[model samples]
Target: MASRSLADFSHPQDFILSILQASPSTRDSRSYLSSFAPPVSVESPSQTPALDVLPDSVPDSASSSAPRTPKPANPLVASLLNPIIRRPALVKIQGPFTDAQLNSIARGMAQLQKLGLVSVIVVDRDDIPVSEPSDAASASRQRTLVLRDVERLVHFLGRHRAPARPILATVARLAGEEEDDTAAEEEKRTPGEVFVEREGLDHIRRAVEEGEIPVLLPVALDPGCRSRRTGADKVLGALASSMSSAAPSTSASGRRTNLTPLRLLVINREGGIPSYARAGLPHLSINLASELDYIRGTFLPQWSHTHPTALSNLALANACLQHMPREASALVVSHRSPAAMIANLITNKPAHSASLPHALLVESEGRVTRDTPTLIRRGLPVRVLRSLAEVDIPRLTALLEKSFRRTLSAEGFYRRLETDLDFVIVIGDYAGAAVVTREDDGTEEGICYLDKFAVLPSHQGDGTVDFLWVALRDETYGLGLADASNPSIGSLSGKGRGRDLVWRSRADNPVNKWYFERSNGFTKSADGKWKMFWCDAEQRLREKAKEAGREFGGGRLARIVEDEERGRLDRWAPVIQSIKSAWV
Candidate 1:
């Protein structure tokens, strides 16, 4: 036999190789070395002998056969005199052993008893010994107790508080068993049923009241039984009903309304009239004096018309009629020209005749020129005035009252007239001599009402006449007179009735058929004059409808009429029948 100390080897590999070399004759040694090295095959265990025994030549200190002795108890513990010391037997039983496990436990307990460690064995529900017999015997002999399960071990420790062996291992084993039991209990519980366990019933009640958990309603029909089973559901239903009843209705009236009144003002120069009325604010008409030289020199020469002054006055009067209030009156202050002729014409005209009661004629002192007198003879209710500065409140008030009364019966006529005409133009001051004429109404029905118009030699080639004609056309369209029953025309219905507009120079005169034709009037009569002119209400409205595409005929007329207005006219028969309560 050969032997060597562990420290004598220079390296582990060298030691292993040296051992193999020394035991060359031993087949087991050769086989072990061959297995340890790479690229070398070793036969299986069935072909090899087991090397379980060691040689006896090895020193006892280095061998597993060294003598064993029991460890002595600490002397310090006796000095302290804490308590009597004793050893408690310990026995471990492996689990998953079934009946075999039980037998092993029994054998361990017996071993402890033989060792004088315990006197009895206590088994658990699993048939594993809670306190093994061998362990109990050892404990009894040594005046100590040993228990396996934590609960039982704790009970034993409480019953026996005397000095004993360390209980760390026993405590660990017991804790493990307790943990396993807790895991099994947890595994048996369902996910949905799991909930945090509160300490008190009051806490649970509060949680329910705060809606931390949903209330489940019972399907039972019995009210009392259902209420008892689902208290949360009943409470929630009551709360919801109460809340619904407490809610406010959404249909309350809270919208704002418009209460502001309307105001309008119209001025006519024909009768030197100024009409004022008010709804919220006053609609006042202020007529200014016309420039006669501009009319004669710049307007008259362009158009062939007799009685230029009369025409001028008529034009002024027409201007006045267009702006006359349907309910109120007009104050006419006569100045330079033939005021009576203009006023009489306005008072006699069909449109103005009805509203004439609303018109007051105040004779003004005629202008003093190189050809006439400074103070002309007073004719009808004439007032002598040195200048415009002489106008007084009393005079103005008297005129206003007289005009108001005169216009009473003419309200309807004035209203219709207002609907038919465009804007009113007041040539001269309201106190001046003027002319009034229905614009564009001249050539429509063969009645040509020409106003003051002339062409000035100086501005003849300047296209002033053309410009004036264009201006008249634009004004006609803008005032809705170009198309009757148009949206714009409908805006002039009520008190805006008797007002009239004026045009002075022939160059700017919209009444002339030739001028009208030149400006795209297109339609011609047998005399080659413009036939499509706005004169009476019916003609004006028909022309308006034709232009707006509301007429029955196609081609130019249909394109001119508006689709909506046409639809309205088409539906008018049914509407009329409905008003009469008769089926159409």
Candidate 2:
């Protein structure tokens, strides 16, 4: 390889292109980008090449007086590095996985490391016992196993080949009661679990800053200097807690700045937290603050003692997320789709959405319908109110207008407030909201009408819409009628008794595709200006019609079905379309 200085390239993109085009390393395997672009397939052999690529731009120092290089001149370059410049993701991999599965995950992580998305990795050796040894001989055997597993993991990842070499490190402290610890610190500690010690963590941080991924082991030592057994999840949790409140780093101009929050990735046999309501499918996203308890109580039991490890993984994610920044999130994905991890870091979206009603449903015989990663976040709290009277009208109006890019008809909005408003779900000071109302079709049966669904333009793709949709579907609308096992039901069940949720959108709206996936049935208005969608309500009506027909005779079944269909078109459809638009 030719010698090159950071200043050789006038732009960050040029520097990146040069690195990608550099000569290939003899020792390292192909880069993860090989399949995408042949010119960028080479991996640098040096363990600290990332730091060398942009030495003049690295900004953790405080003593130097020289001017630092400008930010990446290209949007793509900045996008790749801005979110993860100083934040290293804590990836905990648990196994019983096949070699192919492990290799795929390693390849994906290596790609992320090269692109500057992740700086460190932590592997959990599920084969290693997580219990205390009965004797010294047992402890010795455990040590040998830990060493062997660490070597295998590092070597495996090494073959996938990242810019930063993977090195094995055992750096943790077993939690214990100590007089020097403060009361607040004591509350955060879990006695007998292992966490990375400050000095050891400094060593790891230095390695990362200099371009290396320290593959941490689950082993740690107590204050007594004796080895203790701990799991990888515990180690990851302790590391997250320490780093979340880590002191500010002094910059080149001597200005101290807080570090970005750390992201987490957990690779296990089970992809994500299960959703029994969706026929044993995994949840797409979980708002940890609000939905964690609901998930643990509702979803985990459905596993039926079959996946105890998955339960622990969920708990680990919740624990880790509580210490992360509000914007920071985590992914627990199956080894099958390792590439989804990289996609998530770059795109910041789950491979599949939790709000898509039928998109996540699983078929019988245990075959997965789709490969979706479960996303977990330290979500904003949701406030569910019975009426708009409790809301700040100005803020609510502004949110709806900004989200829809249209003006709201204040008179029309307030017209239904006195008689039709069912409930309002506001997410974190109106970052998103769903206003539903009860609409009577003259048959005395009131239907749940989604009057408005809005999310701030800035918050759209960062999971705000997905989070709000999940809250609406699971809590407000109530899927409990179809599946009584669903525990999220009745939490705030609005007007209808497990009836269909109906909403309308503009005929040319781009969001119709999203609505189509979540809705069971949809119909276009005759005038062609509006489209109406319902959540499995059409099927519900048909079933009811069939039941009613059974009471009379076989001949009456067809007539009953026809009557039901006719009623939907003549009564419900017109009423749904007749509800005037609240936007001008």
Candidate 3:
């Protein structure tokens, strides 16, 4: 309006503001701005009065007749057309949830969606009774109920100031059922008795690419175009398979959209699969290949009748993990803490370390809290080698050098390993390994020393350390006393003796914090150049000492016994520190 070109204003806001300021007094700011011509060429100040005089009540026909430039679409939304740009996560809500819980879940997921995670939510009506449909009419009725449920879920998630434009999506079809007029085929299997055959998956991918969170309905369309109600777990499994194996689809621009299927998350009332052997507590993590059978055969029998859903969830997760990328994992979390999902997305690990002692996992009620989520993975098998011959010494030596950033004295290491090595816990093709040795102190009971804990540089921060630690501390040559009495707790680890574990590290090492958390107590070398840490087994020893003292009627001899036991850590320090260094 001041005879200024578009170049006069560096920012668009300034240009728009200048227009509002120059508007005629006859028209309100809203009317003037809406009717203003596109900022093509700036006009002289005298010409501004003609455009600003238009009233807010201008007819729609006149406005439509005039050619006006449309505002530019958001670039961020356009960029999503390339699927490779998004991290897609599948979140299934297994529910019979209260209103408050639903609100919380919606808020949490919405917050995550806003943070660039393209989430596809599956709502499982686990509360509904599972029954077979007698006829097409019955199946139709069930489909109607499913539609209602999804509608209500969409409405509720959208209504609560949630900021999520959740659209109801139909992405599943009956498996093995074709689009032909096979009414007979549709009738053979009732609506309630169906498995998902993924259809219209592109629509979902497209929606997510455009920044919409697609809330998929579990209902699948049969060959006859009639809807059938299917199990949510089956739907999740189908989706997982399709999403994980999804080939890069070519966009209109002929560029392939490569969306990665990151994680499969199941949110339920029972946070994770319960460890009935551990007094019905939730398992921190489950290595599907190794632990699935034991859980189904041993643990399922304990809680099958009460929580049959857990089995289905576990099966779905296991299937997902098997099909997904090695880095991808599945989770079964409780609705109580929706944030756990976000935390896992960030850390790619369980909220709690899987190697925590069973005694420490429980709350005052003697059961693991319902909020503890179980991370399910297609983890590599853990192997324990008692003899050096079982291991590739050169590879082990290379790993130690790489992880420690120092040369290993192969001669000294092998000598120590030959004599004192209790067990070597190796995880997944040398991704991580721990060397445990029986230290010879003056005490009658030998100390279990963690000699060398090494994880490949490429494998660090992805739970390899925790997985290997679980093997060394709980699975093989056990340390925690609670696990000693309960042999049925872990898989394939004939050892859970719950003996004391001690380890030493350079005083300046960064891993000391992590070691400190896992240990019961620690002490520094007299030279302060080395620090030693011990686990709960030390507490067990102290308790035993107190019991012995009580048995002796608290006499001078009992006092002497207690004093010696209290100074046991001090006595072991010089012996541990005096050992020749393994690194050259």
Candidate 4:
């Protein structure tokens, strides 16, 4: 009836309005538009009307169809031609999330199906429990909290890799939607029952192996995403039986011992489940540098330390950390601050893992040094070049090649540094130079990153780095940060207020101990490639924020344990090789 081509409107509402007005007669439109929804999924980015996914009201005729007798099919190709696709079974489905939020997850699941993964079973919101009363106001508030929880769950799921790859396997239970206290207790797993989960997992393993069908059995390791719709024993039992016709049996670690438990990762912000469950499960506790910002910005800014959401979220994170398994991976998304907090967390006792979760701390290049304060008087005259185009690039490249054993590309370097960079700091007549940028990664703004800090081998052991660090700090923090009263002498005084600095270094470097001492905090990432460090002169920063009349918290940070660091060597390889070829 309407001629609204697919190209016109991005908003669905606008498209619908145009269609309604396009036709004068509305009589046969309903019959025309109400086409039957697809059997597998009812939705896509398309011109057709959207439908529910396998509506319960309409039974799946495909499942009900009798198994057809085999024809004289070729032996080798028969299986491929008629592969038995298992309807993906889901267990332990529960969520306090709103319809819109849950729909996002459904979209993610649908995306997987579109990628050739199939048969995802999801629990409806009607089945989930809520702590608040069934009033419109209470429901609205609950939806907001649930939405936050779902967002974190989605982000974490999107990241799970390696041992926990495809974390959407069969593991979960929706909590009972009950009003009684006993029903609530039924939602929890006591210490002894934690053992049952282990046993159940073993049973599922046996069932999986006996039948060669590939199945995904994901277990939500954190509180926010854990389900009580079915007990672990029941869920795993269901999984085993679904994969194999035989009943699940008592089992132990055998050939399947190497199988890593599927981790449905989640960020715990609501203090949802108690500490006991976490300590018993094979779960990891991740702490990003940005949490401190959330504590400062959203929790502390314009609010006291006693704020419920802020306080509880922080407390929950700490509690989870205490229970982290000895070798469990710790994820650290980069943030420019948290130096003081990180220092407090690091431990020297080798047996105890430095009180840090498998120590994947992030440090960037050109973090400050003890030489900073002294460099104020004796520092090299460093030149700040805003753009490389302003400098003699070939000269700088030749100088870089002599020291770092790599060739540098002027064009590639400029493109990557274009926006976030502050200025290129060159010192000592081209003996050393550093690329500085304010990567506003978290809640607070202008979190500094020393993207590249290179020095000539001739100046290696000299005080060049010391002078550079001091210059960097002086330029960033301003004179007021060093001395608040006059606020007129240093780099940041007249310009915009400065943010914190972060950098990373090769883990094998001998000077790490020196860095460890000079830095507020440091951590080796889980992948063991680089050691990241940060600075948290919190007192000075608070004063600076006060002066600037800006709130100082929330790093807008991410949990970047691996993705951010991946292929860093590849990106720098060409330049390094060029330097070696041209200079060496």
Candidate 5:
């Protein structure tokens, strides 16, 4: 009906073969002439036959025979399909870069800029680039980029590169060589030069040795920031070892000589002091010029200023003691201020120069007055008083009496007085009490005793007890009993004459001991026990008159004889005779 298309062919392979047979590239008349018919022999060939030529047309029995062409390599396809290939311009490397590689990159960059080909030389992470060199104006811009990008480029390159291994043997060799150089340098330095250079390090080392404070140092590199590094653990380990070596030894011999912590204070009496200064007042200055003179001359030179003022007081005191002259003593005189009181106590200086005694306490009655003249006449030096009637009078009397008792007790006097002596006399209700007794020969001897006396805790602030003491001293003196030359029991004791006043508390009274330094009566042996004494007969009669409800006046002494004649003198005949003569 119409011309048949190639699709209408009964066999497509046969149609394509027919087309190939008719093509000139495949047709060969020479091969067709040689193999016009089929092979006759059935035997196999010894060698394989090679095809020499293609036939020009299909044979009657081989209608489908044809030839094929080989395909060419596709450059475009390979580039488009390969996954590993990257654009040359997009190549980048992260850092930190080696010095050598950085230098190389710098050279390569200069070369690129010289070629005038590179438009932009970018650093991938920061996305900034060095400009290509072109005109003079362009060169200026490129120079700016070079300055900014050089360091960054080196850093980026270093990060991407693997760390180089250190040559241990080479480093060791170099260090060995440097040892001589170090020795020479050290030899050149003077002792002072060396000290100056090492002052800070030495200070830190000494602080460590003293166990004063903790030392901290950075130790490792931070991964987030490449520029930062830390201290080596090895260095820390060495420090720890040093600290252990410097630690205070616990053995008896190795222990620190002065293990006790010293307490100190510095006071500025002039104005401009802060309110906070009051808290530290306890450690403040003693009347350094007057009271602490011996200390200033002796011990303070050796003491180091290592602590705050609060911690230096005891050290200063100790130094004061150490430096005192052999012929000098320290005496502390205190005023009303607690700071002054504490400073005086800590110094613990003596009163007299000839004795060179270690310490002394001088109780003053405020500013010296007509009454104080009597004390001065008794060979007592002037001292500042803390209180008129409360602390000063009572405390002075108590301290004197206590010292007297202590001396007597230490000399084995009190034990003998208990039996060998006759009757005891308590001159005043205050610490000024005395024990008067008759010796075996009928002569009267007096033993001044210091008994611990205290104001009741509730009555301490009322000043009642203090006023009572002053009145008692005045009344006793008015009676002619206060004179050291008088025959009163306290004055009669030549050993404690003019210094016969003692104050203490009963051993059973807990509050008394809590407030007082030591609760024991005047002597060390008086501790934790009741103190009793033997007194003369006159003193006994006075006690009985008071017991019989006599008032505190000479009328009471007048009644003592009547009460004693009735029967009281029977037990106190020896004491009565010895002391009665003195009273008459």
Candidate 6:
């Protein structure tokens, strides 16, 4: 590596090019870019159960401990077992990054580490490239690098297990610097230098800019090691690639097919940053300070403060999404992401919508639960039906008309429920039923919309509806239809776990107050006629995960809602495995 000034590179885009392409000279011996590419395959049909009416008696697999191993033909799990060629560890070190900030970051990292989500490295500002103390007399006084911290902890953790060196690529950076955008700008200046105030870090930043020599992360790790790779835990949601500039492909979880290269480079600039920093850099320069605030407030509620930890987290997400050789676009729906999240299948914050679909939300007078609470009394039991096999259409029609004082879409309603219905929770003898639709909008709104929430006029003022809702909330999500027994319904139900259990009510409806109270939040669409109310299933599910001391997020949310009846779960495994890996 011939040393040159950062500004001296005749071709300004050289370093960024090396990183995105994983060039031969600097690329890892094994290929990483292609490992996460969606596998080429034909569309296999989904084996959802036949949608015919079922008899009353059926077997339950809730407690059945059956082996779910795939047949010999199954190759998906085999992909999962592929030896890790290289696990990318993204870490950033900074100056004036206090100890308390590190602790806060450590908490989030510890959570991910427990979930096998990521490995972190925090290099000290003075040890930018990880060098020893120049003042040898006191050299042993401090172990400042985050890698050392992680290694020591890993060693402690592995004491009861096998010893191994995790083949990881540690990409280092300073807190203030996010990307090359500032340098590449026409009005060129160092974004990092301006943001990073500490004198120690400023010097290191100048060195790389002036030196022009690239600091590469791939070659530093032991690339030949074939051990458990990093991020094996997120195989379901973890889509990765080793190439830097591969354009968007359809989304799917691919098994690691090849171990090729890991390539990224950094270089020195002229005394003043050379003309190249503002040149053709491919990725976005993350604004560390700004992004950290969003992450703190959104994800880690307990430690919701802007600090060094948040900057380090930004680096980690950058490594996982931005830096991976074009391998992450599938899992990372970052079109307009607010924070650097692992994935954004379900979110409490809804995307702004332009058009509101046509779904009827009628306001009807009903008994207030708090005013008069009612449980399903004695013989009038709460029945959870999967289909409308036993439904009485006339009675249902009469009930809807009487309650809303409007014409009922009896045929449309039945057809919709028959085709799109997920599950229904009804009061004793169908006094009232809350119908849930699996495909409400047939788009990524990913809502378990309240297709129909009605109680017969006979049962309205007596609190049957209130009792039904309470039971539904306790047993299912909100609207109260489905059960936890079959969570694999996630694909049909909505995106993963934090799906929006949503419904609309007229702005002036009396039920607006009740809907507002029960939901996480709502949005008044561009059209003022409707106010949408929603309960974030994953939000509550995340709370449940915390209570159980478990790793929270989409993964757990997807698992908890599985249908556990009659080997439905076992049947769902192969289906989920394939779906997780399916490319668009």
User: Candidate 2's residue-wise lDDT over 1-584, tens digit each?
Assistant: 12232233335465454433322122111221221113332333333211100111111111011122444332244333333344477888777556666666666666566656554566666666788778989888876766665566667667755444444445778867653454675556656756665676675656556545667667678878776667788788888877676775654544333433457888777667676555566666777666666667665464855455666787888888788766577888777656556555544556555555432233312223334567788776777777667877898888877766667788877877768988787888888777888898876657788888777755655576766776677543344443322223234433335556788876765456566656665788899977887664423444565666642211112223345446575566778877776766
Q: lDDT values of the candidates? A: 0.22, 0.59, 0.59, 0.33, 0.23, 0.32
Query: Any runs in candidate 2 off by more than 4 Å, and if so which?
Result: 1-86, 96-101, 163-170, 181-197, 247-262, 299-305, 364-372, 389-394, 405-407, 474-478, 482-496, 538-562, 573-578
- TM-score ranking from best candidate downward: 2, 3, 4, 6, 5, 1
Between candidates 4 and 5, the lDDT winner: 4
Instruction: Name the TM-score of candidate 6.
Output: 0.27
**Ten contiguous residues with the weakest lDDT in model 4:** 369-378
TM-score of each: 0.15, 0.74, 0.73, 0.28, 0.16, 0.27
Tens digits of lDDT, candidate 3, 78-106: 22122234466778887767666666666
The reply for model 6, stretches above 4 Å from the true place, is 1-379, 440-445, 478-499, 538-584
- Candidate 2 to truth, TM: 0.74
Write model 1 residue lDDT over 215-316, tens digit each, in one string.
111111121221111111122222222222232221223312111100111111122211111111110121111122222332334122322232233243
Model 5, stretches more than 4 Å misplaced? 1-259, 264-415, 420-584
The local lDDT score (0 to 100) that residue 233 gets in candidate 5 is: 21
Candidate 3 positional error at 82, Å: 17
Query: Which ranges of candidate 4 are over 4 A from the true structure?
Result: 1-379, 440-446, 477-479, 483-496, 537-584
What 10-residue stretch in candidate 3 is worst by lDDT? Answer: 47-56
Residue-wise C-alpha lDDT for candidate 5, range 1-584, written one tens digit per residue: 01112222225343233222222111122122112212222232232211111011111111111122422332222211221211101011212234444444433322211211111122211122322244667645543443344345434323433111111110000011122344665344232110112222233333222322212221111223221111112222222222223323333334231111111111111111111111211211122322233222323321322112211232233333232222111221111111221111112111111110001101111111111100000011112111222223334334333422221222244444445433233222332222323334222323322222223222221222222222222222222222111223222322221211222223343233221321111222223442222122223333555788854222112333453234422333333223211110
In the predicted model 3, the residue pairs found to clash are 479-498, 480-498, 481-498
lDDT of 1: 0.22
* Model 3 regions more than 4 Å off: 1-84, 129-131, 135-138, 160-170, 175-199, 222-226, 249-257, 300-302, 361-368, 475-497, 536-567
RMSD of each: 55.6, 12.8, 18.5, 23.8, 50.5, 23.1
- Measured by lDDT, the strongest candidate is 2
Q: How many residue pairs clash in each candidate?
A: 81, 0, 3, 35, 44, 43
Q: In model 1, which regions exceed 4 Å deviation?
A: 1-448, 470-584
